[model samples]
Target: MTALQRIEQGSALQQTDDADLVARIDMLNAIGIALSSENDMPHLLERILIGAKQITRADAGTLYTINDQQKLNFEIVQTTSLGIKRGGSSARPVQLEPISLYRGNGSPNNKLVVTYCALNNKTVNLPDVYKENDTGFDFSGPRLFDKKMNYRTRSMLCVPMINHDGKTIGVIQLINKKSINGPVAFDDDDIHLLQSLASQAAIALTNKRLIDDLKALFDSFIKTIAASIDETSAHTGEHCRRVPYLTLALADAASRDQKCMKDFILNKQQRYNLEVASWLHDCGKLATPIHIVDKSTKLETVFDRIELIDTRFEVLKRDANIARLEALLEAGHDKDRIELIEKQYREEIKQLTDQRDTIRQCNIGAESMPPELKERIKQIAARTWRNCDDELVPFFSEDEINNLLIPYGTLNADERKIINDHIVVTNKMLASMQFPDEMASVPEYAGGHHERMDGKGYPLGLTREQMSVPARVMAIADVFEALTSWDRPYKKAKKLSEALAILGKMKQRNHIDPDLFDLFIRDKVYLPYAREFMDPELIDIDEPSEIPGYPFDMP
Candidate 1:
């Protein structure tokens, strides 16, 4: 043949190979997409295990997830079914029969030569378990063929799943690739390609683990901060913890209605920004002072203004007794009869004590005080405690924001103003902090947390339309954590039921977006959350959903 003719024919062959290569790339890409898309590990494993069998045209396969202890953990995410007669066309989804699987070869006696992969961290391929190197788990596959419904293991391939850290997360085993009514062993090319896929899968799994670890760390830091806030104020001990939990719950519900955060184009930096937004939602609290945050009673810190009313009672008792004695004397009662007049003095004192007790009753109660109660407090406080020896006792503590007049969300008017100003603090804190260029938007997401749906929220007052999806997600996570946490002292920790109900009402009143609340209710997102922080015994699924409106916030 002419040289040109030879080159043309060679080009055609190369083109065919190129087309096949493209097809393989597409398949691998699809598998990678499936693996990385899910946060749930089992589902991800199922997808890969099924892909491994179908791509290799194998009859059965097993996927294992290895732990830090160098053990194999079988995922219930994948299962098997046998006894399918070729002509008996069945119409049911294949049942994944429960395979009793464990981490590490349970007693190390099984012949899957787990040691083979452990030592080599490489692929093992066999033409048949009945012959050849009998070193691995091959014995079990063929034995199953011999004992169960008649089938023989013709070829087997096993590959280690090594994460990015160069540690093996687990192994993937594919069995019996059929070639013309009999099994065919996997070739070098198949092993090489499968190895590549396994490597990619490992990286994805490692990514997920890192995410989980980061979240745990963030939660730990927030818990420590909440404890500090609690410790700073006598009355606000638990408030800091509870608010973040509630905020997170609310944010979770809101996300369902709002946009669920999307993994942005696999950008690591963007991923970081999303996480930062959630963890630092309450970093703004660091700017708020302790005395202002935990102020419980209206007249707290400066004095137990109640003491002033007691003084008034004492004066009233003295006046009443003096009058009663004077009347008795004017009526011709002599000094010898003074003991009879003294009885009236004792009765007056008893009445004043009873009235004082009633005034004290309404002060400590958590519920809202009506105008009558307010008026009563005003009248009694006006009476003056001549005993107060202070300049205004400093209510502001380092970690606690105790402003009694705050009426109990966390800050009083000036304190609330200071607390709200934390948005500015967060904005400045995050904006000045450097991040990789990809996550430059982190500060934007973090700072807008206090912004409201109605443009009434502080700092920016961003409406729902103006907020980014990341900010919305932060908003949910922030609210959920606040409501459900046990670290706050201002109020009792709200159960998932109470928190959701409150969020639902907020959504109804236009304070929070509604769609996210629906998602929070439907997905039971709090189930996993409850398992994380609360004692299992305290988790009450029957928690009441009755959310009474905040008297002041209600229209």
Candidate 2:
């Protein structure tokens, strides 16, 4: 061979190596972009290991992450030659136990190559595991694994994934570097490339974990607020908790409804936003007065005022008895006159007792207050009684009379307004928050639960067209949860049939979203929700047709 020919051959090999280096650099750039974008932890971990294998031409690889217990857990495992795949989106589980970072004596366990790489935050490259004895890493586990699978363990490379903080979070180990001829040792280029890849992987992983931890903290904080609101009033019970469950369930059903909800589909981020909105729907109730929230009776404030009214009635009876006694003394033993005075006193006492009983019943705040009953309350209010200061006052105070005449439920008009204002406050509170773009609609969704479909709802009075689907879905969820909640002080929990019937009427009256309500019944979204949250005794409905708004006739 001529000297010129040999020089040309060397030049050709150098060019090929340069081209390969350029290609590998481009691949690394692409892999970095992918690792940064991947949100799923498992998929991200798998991608890191796979990308390292592709760059080094490795035949098999395993990825391990350090857990809180100071142990290495297998996150992703792949062996191309054996056709073995486990973990990281694969249905097959990684059945191996974790490798503890420390021994029982509290010393670092640096015997295993992966752990050694992790513990030392260093890269380990082995030309041949069977022949390499100076590095002092135990190869018995790999040898046993290879023997069990009838495969050879050779040409290994392990890299520590060090984050920006200089902490080794995990390790990536590659086995059997592949070549056109057969297995070959990983060289300096492979080690450098893998070390760079490991750094990028670590950063991506740390960022993802940090974001996940922040989200978890935010979620727990939101739930804690909801729980605190529930704890503020015994009457509210689990309304805050159950509404989110039903809201998500109904939203899921709507999303799956291809016919009606083609445009109503929610992606993962949208669903999460809706979940946040649902969790914070009643957050404004936190500002509500506890007396109104826990108003078990019409006369309920800090305490029931009926006892005060009862005492006033007793004073009136005492005055009537005093009048009868003075009249009898003035009669001077006229028998017929005495009998008539005694009759008048007895009749007066009975009437006072009946009026007191009537006031007591009125304070209970039944579903409806009859006009006659209201008039009776006014008549009782007109009667006079002397106070402890010896001044005559009306039998009932004006406030007492107003409370007793409440047309329906425990709350009077003012208290009802206060209760309804919670949604307004919720809007204000959520609006004050600096949410991300994805969650910008939270205030609207949470605040719109009280809105009517026909633009009759409070605060903003958004019509069906003005509101989003999530808001409408929340309206139905809120109403249904309230109707079926057993802990409400004013009313008994309605049976499933009764609640559905009322919901049907609401749909017909344009009080709630018509399509969502129909979807709710048709898809039987309430069944699982009822089973999970509703009282067992309240779940009495047997058929969809029995539900008031069910549009379909099941065969």
State each model's CA lDDT, in order: 0.61, 0.91
Q: Per-residue lDDT of 1-555 in model 2, one digit per residue for the tens?
A: 799999999999999998998899899999999998999999999999999999999999999999999999999999999999999989998999999999999999999998888898988889999999888889899989998999998999999999888999999999999999889999999999999999999999999999999999999999999999999999999888999999999999999988777788788988999999999999999999999999999998999999999999898889899999999999998999999999999999999999999988888877788999989988888898788899988877788878888998899999999999998888889999999987888888898999999999988989999999999999999999998988888788889999998898888789999889888888899999999988898899866887754354442
Best by lDDT: 2
Stretches of candidate 2 off by over 4 Å are 328-339, 548-555
Residue 64, candidate 1: alpha-carbon lDDT: 71
Q: Give per-residue CA lDDT, model 1, range 286-350, as digits (tens).
A: 76776555554444444445565456567666668778868787757476556666676677678
Query: RMSD, each candidate, Å?
Result: 9.3, 1.8
For all candidates, the clash counts are 58, 0
Candidate 2's error at 183, in angstroms? 0.9
